[model samples]
Target chain A: MNLAQPIYARVKDHILAQIRSGALVAGSRVPSENELVSQFSISRMTANRALRELTADGFLSRVPGVGTFVREATPRTSLIELRNIADEIASRGHHYSSRIEDLREMMATPNLIDDFELRATTPLYHIAIVHEENGMPVQFEDRYVNPFCAPNFLKQDFSHQTPTAYLLSLLPAEELEHNVEAILPDANQQRRLKISSSEPCLSLHRRTWSGGHVVTSATLIYPASRYALYSRTSLGKQTS
Target chain B: MNLAQPIYARVKDHILAQIRSGALVAGSRVPSENELVSQFSISRMTANRALRELTADGFLSRVPGVGTFVREATPRTSLIELRNIADEIASRGHHYSSRIEDLREMMATPNLIDDFELRATTPLYHIAIVHEENGMPVQFEDRYVNPFCAPNFLKQDFSHQTPTAYLLSLLPAEELEHNVEAILPDANQQRRLKISSSEPCLSLHRRTWSGGHVVTSATLIYPASRYALYSRTSLGKQTS
Candidate 1:
């Protein structure tokens, strides 16, 4: 009856609302394509499309010749090791958003020069981004780049393309060095992530090397309570 | 000279003391073998063996033409990815210690039977251990095992060796499942780890599979501030 929204969206939302609100539990059969078509006065194709998309997005699982059932809500988590954060979130069928908090060119500091082995006078590009999933901020990324490694670094709209994606699109890193640490968040981090001050944070520091040069050094901070890196796939090198 | 300690240990202690105390900084060359042989009135082989052991232990880097120099103090961290914790710490030249908190044979709970897909009323082996490094506690391990998988599970002395080492010795896992989470320390965990209650802990859960069965499920928890997982080695898949 809501004419403002499209018919397909309205139908999808009506079914999704039931699933999310626990009206339809996992393994419970969803409305059949015919039932949906007749109940909503929608075409058969529209009902099929809604179910198909829902299955693709992991909301439902369809058994051939049988009916579709609500699925368990545990999303397959991202492979967080040196992965592009945007692509990782998108793969799980979640909305991905980024806020470019700071981006500018600055002279390489002593620590950068020492760690990155850059010349003292070499100018560097610094970028800070807050990445969110479904409107909740999860990670804060602070990255520094070597100008020679990525020229024209400052011109792009990061909202459209992430810095990591753009960098990989230009050239994949030959080597990645990663270090993970746990720390208590400061006041500013608490505000940015909207987490409690007592929250512990997992800080992942990564160095990307390309063409025998340190291309970029990034520090990604995540509220430990909100997110974690997980893996379950096997390498297939089995014993026994 | 202290008569109680052996000569080689004295020589090693002297050199190590300087390096650890920052009396000799990184890249600073140590006294030559001949000079050590004369200064301590020791044999040529004693000096050579001490230097060689130091190089092997990562305290010094020896160049063929140049003399041995104090190395950077950053120890190559243990590969924490389902690695044998004892070997990992040994590889980093640190003392590894484990306290067996609890080990017993018990009936599998409903949750364990559900998560592990075991038959109800099956007996399970439960183990709790606190792993320490350099006299500091770092990780607390809680584990459950299917007795049919490792029939002699209760006989091993975990103090001399780790439970992981024993399980892996019997049969290498065909599949491994890992999940990581962050949580504030509970009173029990804080007491076991000797960490403040406010500290956040990184909890890694692992399931090891063999012969299409989950042999062991382990929950390893570490105080975030004290230890971290680090890697600087390359995978060697080149780009650019």
Candidate 2:
């Protein structure tokens, strides 16, 4: 904020402006350090600092042997962080709702027998729910539950309460794994979500465990245009 | 694999296998709980456990007023944790190399004057580099440096060392900030990265600073098909 501040920041803002204004298009190279010194009439040290900082911030790319160049701007892409969809939507001032489609108990099939390493006649509970945001369908929640993990799940009314909330109340989890991706929506999804065939959808596959048993698994689908993922990283366990 | 194990895992796997084997096509509703219980001749508890776990795993959807339905399978996407890009490619058994494109010193522009709060004529350095994996172009790095933070950067032989490695050697950082995103590849990027127009690209915009002075800023780009972003989250932080 004063004269004592380094020249690097001064130069970085200048370059960043050019980028924001499209004057410095993607892949375009800026002047070299020597050129910068002569152009700005500044010391070589100052010019070097500016470029070095810019390279580390990811606005420019420096190849050891080649030269510096402008990096392309990517939009709507961020480190995918784990977040509750309901929280995300509600924060934006939207009404969030879920309609439970079905809930029942049944016998495990042969494949289930193998996957859960269960006996031929193990029992499980299955539930399907449609999640809506602002009266528009956003995700279809297809979930499988370990009854032993949350015994009273069937008695709870999901229309006013989310399974995530209920399950957390019944059992606290120690570990969680989540996977997400983009894919084409199927016909039923298209109809339920009221999205067209041309639109791609984002899907999240999640598995959560507690007490060394698989507590729950869920597939959550979202209309691609409706959601974007966000995440941040630090050197250690810091979160922002 | 035994009776003592939970029934949920087995049922979830059974549904997944059915979907994978095309026994249950997309958009098809799965059998109701009563049907499953009768078919497997298992207790309602066992059937419920299977369905519940499968739903959580994203294999099925249940609508309370409607019925239980088979959900489309979405690819399981995972976030690529934030780390040194060089380290990432190296982990995949590849040689990574970077070419220094340009290096020079210059005066700060009007924007730089404001952002870095510098005098109108402060000096700065600009550097550019391109990173490659096994000779295949991957990331184009453009960077700006703050010379005041690392005065001897100009004298460093970047060809023999990475800017990150060199800078870290000169000054140890105590704090950092990062931003990442995805965007369509531009013409220059398409040519430099040898990616086609149809291919989307992932880009990262990062900024790191120490001691309240902006140290570095950079932008990194990668082809969409070649990479995906990932991250992990824990509940302890939120509760604590």
Candidate 3:
């Protein structure tokens, strides 16, 4: 018992230590404020504050008219990050490999005008690569790049480095946007990913910008069973 | 032309006008830097800079040996904002409705011990709701609440307000987390959402925290064809 600390804090710490030490397990009733005042020779307000603070902190739960009990532990807050697929697999201690299916410089079409903001006949490089982890096909990537951003895109040796890695090395994305959809794989996607038609796939379309220019627009499809996305956002400043 | 501005900016604005006015149509070639230098009596470097900056801003594309042509318009930068579902529907000018499938108090299970970090016997409030737009089922919501956070969760009249609205009114989430996956709905989910088994669904699991305590954990399921998620993230400060 640190005498320098406030009386309420000392009481809270004592209860916390008991809970941490497994003496007060989850859902087990905690000492009532009256019981705490009698046991510790403290005022009712001091005992009440300790329990109230603990309840608000998730260390305990208060059932009105019933009793306060130890709360269950909650999940830790997640960290949301946008990372390259190859690096993601590597960090998992798995080998990353890719097979390039197609690479070409094609004229942009009308529909692509919306995605790339380029006129038709504008030369854009398109590439398709199947990313594998531990010999299993996990993602199929289809991408279109503005040739002005990566003039040597089609000529790069992708077997040694992924396109995402190459792009990041040259022009790092200053802005990123994602449109996610739940999809049933098309026959071509199923064949490339080796998935059944019934299996749902996560299709993530990502666009990156660098130096105020659209760098790349890419679609990566992953089998849902193999991958899930986690994102954490701060809402502390929002009012409505 | 504004003579006070740099000569290069004047030339760039001239070309931008033609492009924006439909005189220089999409895929049409722009005057070469040499032509611009001679035509405007400007320095070659100035002409070069004007074209280079235009290309970088997605106004034109240079096809190496070919020539610089107007580029397609790219999608505008997206703003990522989190919003409530009922509000989202109302903003679309659609009538929002809901059916409360089940609302009860239950004991936490061993598996949920990881999610809520509570003992198995910890009491939690559970609710299942089917959300409709114009009488068509669109989403199935299942949620578990910490009784300490919302003791009246099961007693609320969901017909007038969503559980999300009720919770947000009492406790504003300081931190929000999401786990998104593509899935085929189980029989119960399918029946509740009134969807075919073959249809794909987007499953979004969300958890919110307020005052350092977990407020609620919810799973929202939407049909893939009917819903998609958009998120924009800033990557300016990231190095790796």
User: Which candidate wins on TM-score?
Assistant: 1
> Comparing to the true complex, what docking class would candidate 1 get?
incorrect
* List of clashing residue pairs for candidate 1: none
lDDT of 1 by residue, A33-79 (tens): 99998999999888987887677555788998999998765222212
Per-residue lDDT of model 2, residues B1-240, tens digit only: 023545545555566657655788768988877877887777777787677656644567788867678765432222443256677788999998877778888777775554343444567677777788898887877666777877777788876677776766665443354444335568988877888765656565555544345676666776756654443444342231
| Model 2 misplacement above 4 A | A1-82, A98-132, A136-147, A151-156, A178-206, A218-226, A232-240, B1-82, B99-130, B140-160, B167-182, B231-240
What is the iRMSD in Å for candidate 1? 11.4
The predicted structure with the larger DockQ, 2 or 3, is 3
| Candidate 3 lDDT over residue span A179-210, tens digit each | 88899999999999999999998888989888
For each candidate, what is the lDDT?
0.78, 0.65, 0.80
Candidate 1 TM-score over all chains jointly: 0.68
Q: Which lDDT value does model 1 have at A26?
A: 76
Question: Candidate 1 chain A: worst 10 consecutive residues by lDDT?
Answer: A73-82
Per candidate, chain B TM-score?
0.68, 0.59, 0.63
Q: How good is the docking of model 3, by CAPRI class?
A: acceptable
lDDT of 2 by residue, A62-89 (tens): 7655778887543232333334556655
The fraction of reference interface contacts (C-alpha pairs within 8 A across chains A and B) present in each candidate is: 0.57, 0.07, 0.73
* lDDT at A81, model 1: 51
